[model samples]
Target: MTPSSALKAESPSALETISRNPRIRIRRSGPPAEDAKCVVYWMQRAERAVDNPALDVAIDVANELDLPIVVFFSAISNFPSANLRHYVFLNQGLRDIEADLAERGISFIVRRPPKNSLEALLTELRAAMVIGDENPCREPERWRSVLAHRLKIPYWTVDADVLVPSGLFPKHYFALHIFRPKLYAHFPTYLVKPENPKPVRQWQRPPNFESFDVKEDLTEGWKHLDRTVQPVDYLTGGTHAALKRLKDFVANDLAHYQDRRNHPEKAGTSHLSPYLHFGHIGPLTIALAVDQALKQKVITKEAYDAFIGEVIGWRELAVNFVKYVPAYDSIDCAEPWAQKTLREHARDKRDPVYTLEQLEKAETYDELWNASQMQMVKFGWMHNYMRMYWAKKILEWSQSPAIAFENAVYLNDRYELDGRDPNGYAGIAWAIAGVHDRPWFDRPIFGTIRYMSAASTGKKFNSKLYIRNVMENEPPPLLT
Candidate 1:
């Protein structure tokens, strides 16, 4: 913020501050319908009712128009690579929103497509306007654009999930150093904890257009939904679960976060990626909790800074990556230097080129790489350090950079709970195509792209224990 606009940001009154804030972007025509009933909040990316900028804007606008707000969420069976596991977790989150909204005298309705649609629901409810949350990914972005063109009434979206509203930064950031100062400089205006407000008038249930039960399996009858990948048992969805995990991490594991975060054998890192990806928790909520922990002298500043740098820095950087870069999810998104270097050595020969099936079946010769794959398959997550190693090895084993990108994206999206996300895409690009990373020593297949030797990376952590965990959780044939 400039010296002229550096006012002390009010924490409790954060919602009010964001009423006409830069975080909001108008998608459709303005001037809400004069003879309309309720305001519909098209809950998309940010699923939670707490500490959500999107929900805050809906309430603020509804209050101004003297109308009750109705939150409408639609669950489509085929969301790119979404499967049964992803739907289950999403359904759990919808239930959480249902209960949370009830407490605040708001309403939540979950609908499906073909028969049930957002436009139909809005028309039935006679909605004055619509407030939605933002998603930078290609498909979701296209969804919002399509919806905006369809809706006649005022439609706007808030960059709810990200701490820094992605719209503010218009360019693609090459590295953290280039993006760090620019992001932090605007934190004064955007980074405070958002106080989610209740609607001024409670939602009045209409006589028609019934909503699906949140407790039931919404994707049960949809054959298009992939049921091959079953939901894992280790993690539960919902904002309450996210908060519990956050509190536990801050109280117990944060002190050792810096030291043990890279060790795959230990649970030192805050396993909040799934929650963050699903919008079960807001970034500000986690940030404020960590800052308070630091203030209480529970964790050292070094640990605090390190955690923030990884969780906050790298995350928003990925968001910026997806927001600006058109081909973010492909090998075409790699830097020019990386592209040239990789192409120069494209035909150098992959000694043990494994097909997608072999990699998916975890039949790789490298024990540690196989363990990382197993971790993602069995646990729906992999250690951050191992993920880097995992992707780098795919590059070493694939025919070309484009092929590596395809295989990595396929496995990552198919297994991990937080798959099909900016972070996952950026991570794969970094490991395989060198998106955010600097060029390193030239190699045969990898070229200037960074290389992670399995032998060297294994020495950094307890690979034996990690492999043991995978073996115990995975089927016996997985290791062979």
Candidate 2:
């Protein structure tokens, strides 16, 4: 068959592979515009060129039509819970993606508008189809829905952030034990790498549109964003940096991860949360690399599986939690028993009750708690083990459970790069209320909810060392 005839015959079913994949979902069902020019990828969550199914789908659809692809990322100035730190980190990663995409002959345009600029861009391009990554977060979800409705072309969203897409499972799973097996069942089918489509036509120039140069605009972008929270120099965001961290973790830390994870003084954890949160790296990329280490015998299978369980298991479970539970960040989503028990102890508080100001400044009696707070404030990151103790104390010291929950979420989302995420929301819920935990022994203020004390934490790790290290070290200068 002639090349033109072959493409015509296969073009009808070219999108079938994407349509049938469990990872991809069609948000709006309409045939591609017959006389359209290019396929558009409205990039949001997944920032990397590598291992992105959404991008792959866009490439495939564009190739079938023998057309070029245009990728647009709307860097809205007022993304919820985002500040200077988050923007700096996210834009740095975006710079990497733009350079990478340029090498592959795809246009990567970014806009920093305060309003919804998607419809304008889509209309300008006269795109045949629109593609985007699936994000369960409230803000992204709303924006995507609005944009999809505005577009007159076919719009599809692909799940590339999580290893097993969040949509595959039931809206909410009670615990890791219940969700882990079900997640594993589909591993054989969905864990493989996504198809990478070769474009038949290459995009020559920047799409005939005016947009912000990510690197240049970032400086002025910060001017319009909240500058209260400054970017930390400790973690530079990008796929290259994220990959380096993952490589080092697999080589040095993965073997001891299961054993030393809880020790605050040790570097046993992979500090890739910021990168993962910003979509600089995908979970599947991290998981596949860990799996390769296991095959090479560089790391034990036990450690490999343990880390994978976390990368896919608990992380995706948290995504599931927020997907099903709209009020996941607040006390409204707490288990019935937990809500009842917490209310019973509402009037039982007796000791010092600190205000949100006091807490944000890390001015507390407990040295360990203060250090943890300081770490989060100064470094834009904190020890995983310290997070549990850090949050419980907020509940123990606040005037009310509701106030405590609000303060915890505010401080967490305000400072951390990984803030406003499912993991953060679910983690806070677990700490303040027994979201996935069973009722513990009744206490004065805690009642049946799980209680974590500084005393108990001290018994597990050298609290003095954690405090001393955090206090003595100087954090890297804020990125400008």
Candidate 3:
């Protein structure tokens, strides 16, 4: 039979393989007859066994090769620029992931790295083929590139985070308007129903390795590591909680999402950004659920489209931006006009210079800004709409644009569970540096990044009520 004919004749039930780079390959390797041909070195994303493209592809490849699949997660002592808050959230998520994998008949191995990158751990695992969830961010991408080069075996990077693969589009997107049409056109192709994992009848014993409890090791191991950052205690992490949150949102809040999402006090939003950022829930699952809701006529197309725009259009654009522009995290990725404008406005005078400590402690003069900061500090997440106003205030209050950008990133990464995401970086850049944003009415420090003010927020919604509710009810350190 011809290769094309064989391909056509194959069962339609087979798992679909999606690759960004055509040169990437997945092959059977390592010990013979052991039934562990494809070993997935799971990194970046966590939790759900369902709706995960990487885990699904790995399982399918293992089944085809008649081998069992083993999933490995490497925990390094020191992640570059990561603070105590980042570790706390990630560790909590991982703890939940370990339990979930065990229930699914998959072996979960946690290997401790000597340092941040998993170079030493991957080398020690001798994995036949390492598979990781694609992340356009600096650390994960750097780690993947190092692994692909250093590992003797083949490596696969799967786009499980975004609805559309980052590689499907060109390296950088011009703007949200430009990227929106492209995402809408490809939604059908990437929004297929998620494949469920068929339970494996035979279990493959994992090779003996050192067990590193993320919580205990993180606390104990901090002293031994090169870095001196503290561990955070923000929001609870892990797949179980993420799934629970999704179910809760759908049952309790999704109906009111259209009306109350913009209000900070209502808890009407999904609050899934952190989970999405960490890969606890796949974008496909969210899309499917939202699509189903739309079909049921539970949500208006306008509302559904708005939500989808965020997940697909805006989110994917950020991923695409980072993927193409290597210096996306830096100021160089900003448009030339924006760069010049920001530079000119960098030294502009401020109403009051708020130190990083003041911002971090939510001690700003604006009660609304303080409330938002408190939310980020205590809950580790913020409403999407308010996040813009929150970030813009930081730009206005700091001594300079550069200092404002630095403080904004520091606060977000330290407090928000969804911090360290491409979206987070893009949001900060958009607020401070005007990356991907068009020029608007001139402002002091922002210099045409589009200004958002407390008055504007109040005009859009019941600002007084929202502020009162958050300040009174959202719990302390924040309420204080």
Q: Using lDDT as the measure, which candidate wins?
A: 1
**Candidate 1 segments whose C-alpha is farther than 4 A from its true place:** 1-19, 207-209, 474-480
TM-score (all chains, Cα) for each model: 0.94, 0.94, 0.84
- Tens digit of per-residue lDDT, candidate 2, span 243-349: 99888888888887788788887678888888888888999889888878888998887898888887788899889998899888788888889999999999995
Q: What is the C-alpha lDDT of each candidate?
A: 0.86, 0.82, 0.68
Per-residue lDDT tens digits for candidate 1, residues 366-389, read 999999999998878888999999
Worst 10 residues of 3 by lDDT: 23-32
**Taking the candidates one at a time, how many backbone clashes does each contain?**
0, 0, 6
RMSD to truth, every model: 4.9, 4.5, 5.1
Model 1 has an lDDT value of 0.86
Candidate 3 C-alpha RMSD relative to the actual structure: 5.1
Lowest-sum lDDT 10-residue window in model 1: 2-11
lDDT for each residue of candidate 3 in 34-104, tens digit (9 for 90 to 100): 32344554656644566777777666655655556667676666665556666666677777776767776
**Cα TM-score of candidate 2:** 0.94
Off by over 4 Å in 2: 1-11, 114-116, 206-208, 217-224, 474-480
